[model samples]
Target chain A: DAGITQSPRYKITETGRQVTLMCHQTWSHSYMFWYRQDLGHGLRLIYYSAAADITDKGEVPDGYVVSRSKTENFPLTLESATRSQTSVYFCARRTDYGYTFGSGTRLTVV
Target chain B: GIQVEQSPPDLILQEGANSTLRCNFSDSVNNLQWFHQNPWGQLINLFYIPSGTKQNGRLSATTVATERYSLLYISSSQTTDSGVYFCAAQTGANNLFFGTGTRLTVIP
Candidate 1:
C-alpha cells in the first residue's frame, strides 16, 4: 500500500515479554501517532512524534515506549507486555487536514 | 486535554434510512475529524471538518467551532454502513481526543 501500514496485523505474546509494533508511512508526514482502542474508552493516544527524533507522550503513555528514528518509521514497543496492554493498536499520519490511519494491530498478552 | 462526547451511543436502522451523529468538545480544537471503523477494524476517514460543512457522496458533516460541536449525517444508510462512527478532535498538540463513539447497525 502507498499510504500507511502496520506490521504483524495480529500478535500474541506472553506477559512480561517485550513486543514491538511497527508502523511505516510512505507520505513522509511530519507527525505520526500511536493509539490503542479499547471497549469503552474508544481510541487513546499512546505516543506521537512530531518529526524524526522529536517525540512526546499522549494521554496514556505508561508501560509503552515509542521511537521515531526516521520520519517514515515510527515503532511502538512494550518493554514488558502485560495483559492490561492487550488491545488493538493503530498508527496514523497527520496530513495537512486530517489523518491517514493504518489497519490496526490486535495484540493479546497471556 | 479536551473532553469529546458523542451522542446516541448506539443506533439501529433499516436500509435507506437517514441518521445523524453529533460530537461535542469541551475546548477549542485545531481540527475535527469523523471516522468510520468497519467490522474488521479499519479506520476510514470520512470527513475532516474543523468548521463549516463538507459533504462527500452520501455523507455530510458540519462543525461549528464557536459552538464546539460537530454533526455527521449519513443518508440512505446501507448494510455496509453497519459499523462504529467516531469523532476525534485535535488541538494544536499532536494527540487527538476521541469520543466514546456511536455504534450503528444498519439492517438489510
Candidate 2:
C-alpha cells in the first residue's frame, strides 16, 4: 500500500472523450514513467518525467499527455481516447533498489 | 535506442523444477530490471541487476554488461509463478525498453 498506485483500475470511455489515468508514489522517486502494454508487444513507454515540471516524450506519445507537477504524482491523459489506445497502462517509479510498478489500469474505448 | 530481446518466448515447467530465462540487449545499459506480471496485471520487480549477480529467496539474476545479456534463474518453481516475465534496460537515465517477454507456465 505504500508503493505506487493507479486509479480507476478499469475504465471504459468513448473514442472522442478525454480520460486521465492517475499514478501516485510515496517514495518521491526522481524518475516516473507511464507505459502501455498490448498483445504481442512489450510495455511501451508513453511519457516520463525526471522531476516536477520536467517531462519528455517516449517511444509512443502520439495522443497521450503527461505532467508531473509534484514528485509524488504523475498523471497521464489521453487527449482524445481512441480504440487503438485500449490496453493495460502501468505507472512505475525508479528507486535506488529498483523500479516500483503500479497494478495497472485497463482502459477500453468504444 | 537500444533493443531488448528475450529468449524462450514461452516456457513450461513442473512444480519444483528449475528454469532459466535469458535476455539480450543490442547496446550497453545503465539500468536493467526484471519484472513478473501476474494474471491481475501487476508488474512486480524481481531484480535490478545492471551488472553482477544478486539473489533473493528462490530467485536470482545475473547481468553481464560486457556481454550485453542477462539471465534469471528460478529454482523450485511454483504454481504461483505462472505468468509473464519481462526484462527491461535503459541507457543513461532514459526510460526502459522492455523485452517482448517470456510467458512461463508452472503445472502441478
Candidate 3:
C-alpha cells in the first residue's frame, strides 16, 4: 500500500464535463510526472513537477492541467474534457535510479 | 529534446525462443531505463542501465551510452512476457522521454 496509486481506474465522462485524475505516491519522490498514452503516439508527457509547488509543462500539456501542492500528490485535471483526451493516463514518480508508474486510469469521454 | 527510436516495432516469438529489442537515441543521455508494460497495463521497471550491462532472471540489458543505443534481451520467453517494452532516456532533463515501444507477443 506504500507504492504509487491512481484513483478512478476506469472513468466515463461527458465531453464538456470536468474530470480529475488523482495520483499519490508514498515514496515522496522529488519528481512526479503525468503522461497520456495514445495509439501511434506512444507516451507523451503532459506535465511534470520537480518538487512541491514547482511544475513544468511537458510535450503535450494543452487541454490538461496539473498541480503539485504536496510532494506526495500530483493530480491532473481536464478543465473541459474532449473526445481526443480519451486515453490511458499514467502517473509516475522518479527516484534516483528510475521511475515507478501507476496502474493507469482509463478515461472515456462520450 | 532528444529523440528516442525503438527497433522491431512489432515481433512475435515462440515460448522457447530468444529476442532482442534495440533503442537508439539522437543525443547523449545521462540516464536510460527499460520498462515492461504487461498485458494488464502495469509498467514495471526492468533495468536502469545508463552504461554497462545488467541481468535479472531471463532478462538482460546493455546500454552503450557512448554509442547512444541500448539493447534488451529476453531468453526462454514466457507467455507472461507478452506485452510492450519501452525504453526511456533523460538528456539532462528532469523528465524522461519514452520511445514508441516494441510490442512482443509470445505464443506458447
Candidate with top DockQ is: 1
Q: Please provide, for model 1 over A1-110, each residue's C-alpha lDDT reduced to its tens digit, 9 standing for 90 to 100.
A: 42999999999999999999999999689999999999987899999999999999998999999999899999999999999999999999999878879998999999
Any runs in candidate 2 off by more than 4 Å, and if so which? none
TM-score of candidate 2 chain B vs. the reference: 0.98
Report the poorest 10 consecutive residues by lDDT, candidate 3 chain A.
A1-10
Question: For candidate 3, what is the DockQ-based docking class?
Answer: high
Candidate 2, B1-108: lDDT as tens digits: 789999899999999999999999998998999999888778888998999999999999999999999999999999999999999999975788899999999999
TM-score of each: 0.97, 0.97, 0.97
Ranking under TM-score, best-scoring first?
A: 1, 3, 2
- Counting only residues 3 or more apart in sequence or on different chains, how many pairs clash (N, Cα, C under 3 Å) in candidate 2? 0
For B1-108, candidate 1 gives per-residue lDDT tens digits of: 899999989999999999999999999998999999999999999998899999999999999999999999999999999999999998877788899999999998
Clashing pairs in 1: none
Q: CA lDDT, every prediction?
A: 0.94, 0.92, 0.93
> What's the true lDDT of residue B87 in model 3?
98
Report how far off residue B58 is in candidate 1 (Å): 0.6
In model 3, the Cα lDDT at residue A75 comes to 96
Task: Output the worst ten-in-a-row residue range by lDDT, candidate 1 chain B.
Answer: B90-99
lDDT of candidate 3 over B1-108, digit per residue (tens): 889999999999999999999999989988899999999988999999889999999999999998999999999999999999999998988778899999999999
Tell me, per candidate, how large a share of the native contacts it keeps. Answer: 0.93, 0.93, 0.80
